[model samples]
Target chain A: MAETVKLLFSATRETVYMVAVSVLIASIFGIPLGVLLYSTDRGRILENSPLNKALGTIVNIFRSIPFVILLIMLIPFTRWLVGKSIGTTAAIVPLSVAAIPFMGRLTETALREVDRGVIEAAQAMGASPFQVITKVLIPEALPSIAAGITITAINLVGYSAMAGVIGGGGLGDLAVRYGYQRFMLDIMLYTVAILVVMVQLIQVLGDLVVKYLSKHR
Target chain B: MIRIRNLTKVYTSASGTVKALDGINLDIEKGDIFGIIGLSGAGKSTLLRCINLLEKPTSGSIEIDGVEMTGLSPKELKEMRKKIGMIFQHFNLLSSRTVWGNVAFPLEIAGFDRKTINEKVENLLNLVGLSDKARSFPSQLSGGQKQRVGIARALACDPKVLLCDEATSALDPETTLSILKLLKDINEKLGITMVVVTHEMNVIKQICNKVAVIEKSRVVEQGTTFEIFSRPKTQTARNFLKSMFICEIPEELKAKIKALNGNLAEGRVVKIGFFGEITAKPILSEVVKKFGVNANILYGNIDNIQGTPFGTLVVQFEGKNGTADRALSYLQDIGLDVEVVEIG
Candidate 1:
């Protein structure tokens, strides 16, 4: 039982590391990707139909692949990135890749929800195309964008747990190795309990942040 | 001065092409309050948009302050747009921003230094009477207060031309009057050329020195507000003024006069429009005394436009034949514009 507690603590840290690194990585590229996808549509700010269509197709193709399949498929690339394909850092590669398209599409939806009249008012005030995006579009869509981020972050947590299926060394890996394979029911229930608690904390924190932001709005 | 000549705009969609503006020729003098009046979908808003190149005109020459705007490059056009301020019917104040921030946006766009922006925005907030609500967000404001923020924002860059696209149409009547007065004060104090587009005649009567009536994408008539109100040449203008309930009688009264067939004094409804001296002259009483014609006033509305007394009255004369005719002729001779609505 003491060994289980020690292992659970270590496993929880690994999962936190994997989720945090992947979410940070996904946000860095995914936000720009989403903005480009939205702005390059025909008659939009960037207004490149060909680029928009190609980018959209690529995001859709990636988004359609299952997370488990994506993780398996990215093994070689993950190995090249982190020098090993079976550890926690390696799991981040597939997780970040899977999160990119998901975050992009969600951010695009948030941007689309911004009022067109507000965009026009910015233009009428002589805002440059870049200023319209930075000042008006982004700020106006911020509340919805914050909500989208919460949804994405929650999804990434679930995805991080799934990473343990393939020897990624998180709570799921501990549960599968000691509980399922070793016939230890207590370990299985403990991992599940911990996962549920982490998800609850994420949800509460996300809601509090969104509520605070919407209040200022 | 803003000169728009031979302006035409066509909008093409997947369904079909619609001509929104056609051959719209207008010369709006600097410091004058101009109005463009039309019904919904009559291209009034479209015309206003074309002025700022928000809705680019298919063909036209728009010259403001000696610069032809239609031919400018995108960057140059954007630079030019900074001088042409616009307020909307919806009061398009940025919802996420405070009233001060909303007003400061344009100045910020123009890249004015922070200190200059603060001073100018402060002066503008005072000008529009929203200084007390500077920290308040748009959602917290009433429609009138939101528009006051909008007005302050539009004036932030010290624009030479201000375009109001039905600015007062969204507000209640009392709020509308206050906004109109603010606009009038702005026009007087800043001498910014104003082009207002609205469906209401009272909006035109309140501030516009010159007005153009639009119908079916054409400028049907253009003149001084007093001239348009006193003598509406086109059926569209007449119908428009009829809505104001000031110039023309109600349709029921018109039908009633049309149905009656009697002597000139008994049946004829004469529309008497006067400006200047006749408004003060009690001309109707004079006509009654001179001709012994019992002039029953059916409708009357008098207004002071630009410090000039202008009014219209529809009266049915009930007296002998030659006396009523001579009385009307005498009114015309005295320079009171008279139109016989239902001739007996």
Candidate 2:
């Protein structure tokens, strides 16, 4: 029973590390790409149809691939990039790759909700397109975008657990090695409880953050 | 002054084509409060948008202070737009911005320094009687207050002309009047040319010195408010005036009168339109005394148009057979419009 608790704690820590690192990397890249995707469309400020369509299609294709398949497919690239593919650190490459497309879509949805009339008001004030994006669009969409980020982080947490299937040292890997294969019911029960607690914590944190950020409420 | 020549705008929809503005030509003098009035889908909005190039005309030339706007380069067009301010029906202030920030937006776009922007925004907020609301977002303000913010923001750049597109339609009548008064005050204080588009004749009557009535994408009547209301030329104008005056005997009323008044003759009914000073001098009494015609007022409406009184009266005349014709001629000679109506 003690052994099961120790393994569950270690798996929980590793899962947290993977989710944090991947979500950070995803946000770094995804937000700008999402803004580009939103602004560079027909009738928008940038209005480059071909560029917008090409980038949008690429993001959609990446998102359409199931995360499990994506993790396996990214193993060789992960190893080549990170010098190993067996630890939680190595799993971050696939996790961030999956998270970027997810976050990008969320960000696009957030930005799309900003009133077009607000954009026109900015333009009527003689604001350049760049100023409109930086000053008006981003500020207006901040709350929704923050909520979107929270949703992305929660999704990354779930994906990080799936990473344990490929020998990434997280809760899922511990459950498989000791609980499933060795038939240790005590380990399985402990890991499942910890996983539920972690998901609950994340959901509560996300709800608080969203509530704090929302201006409408 | 602003001049729009040969202005045309065509919108293509999935179903068919709509000519929103067709060959519109207009000249608005500087410092004039001009009103463009029409029903919904009457192209009044389309015409107003063309002034600021918000809705680009298919083919036309717009000249503000003798500078052509139609063919300017993109950079120049941006600069040109800064000289023409506009307010909308929805008070399209940014929900995310405070009143101060909204008012300062144009100055910021103009790249004014922070100190100058702050001072200008403060002044504008005070000008709109919203200094206390400088930090409040638009959602916290009432409709009239939101529109005041919109007006202040549009004025931030100190544009030479202000285009108002149904700016008061969303407000309650009392609020609408206050906003219209504010617009009039702005015009008087700044000496800025103002063009307002509205469907309400009362709006035009309140502030507009000159008005153009648009119908089916054409200007059916364009004149001073006095001329348009007093001598409406087109059938559409007459119909619009009927509603405004509310004294034009309807077909139902005429039928009822024929059935109710058995003594009424075929040519005894007439409608009279009186304008300005003529409405004050007991013109009906003058006609009655001079022609020995007995006047029975069936309907009457008197309204003020831009501080000038205009009136309409529908009456039945009974007298010696020839007296009715003499009374009609006498009214006409005194500058009243006398339209004879059939009676039983």
Models 1 onward score TM values of 0.94, 0.94
Docking class of 2: medium
DockQ per candidate = 0.66, 0.58
Give TM-scores of the second chain, every candidate. 0.91, 0.92
Write the residue-wise lDDT of candidate 2 on B1-344 in tens digits: 89999899998879998899998999999999999989899999989988877778899899999998788776787887788888999988877677888888888888899999999899888878899998888888999999999999999989999999899999999999999999999999989899999988878888999999999998988999888887788887777776667756777878866764576563377788877888889888888998888898987788888778887788888778788888888888888878876666
* Least well predicted 10-residue stretch by lDDT in candidate 2 chain B: B259-268
After superposing candidate 2, which stretches have Cα over 4 Å from the reference?
B12-17, B265-267
TM-score of chain A of each: 0.95, 0.93
> By DockQ, who's the top model here?
1
Candidate 1 lDDT by residue in tens digits, B1-344: 99999999998999999999999999999998999999999999999998888888999899999999899898998898899899999988787789999999999888999999999989999999888998988988999999999899988888999999999999999999999999999999999999999999889989999999999999999999988877789998888877865665667777667765353434457888878767887788888998898788877888786668877888787776577778888989999888888532
Tell me the TM-score of candidate 2's A chain.
0.93
What are the lDDT figures for the candidates, one per model? 0.87, 0.85
**Candidate 2: residue B151 Cα off by (Å):** 0.6
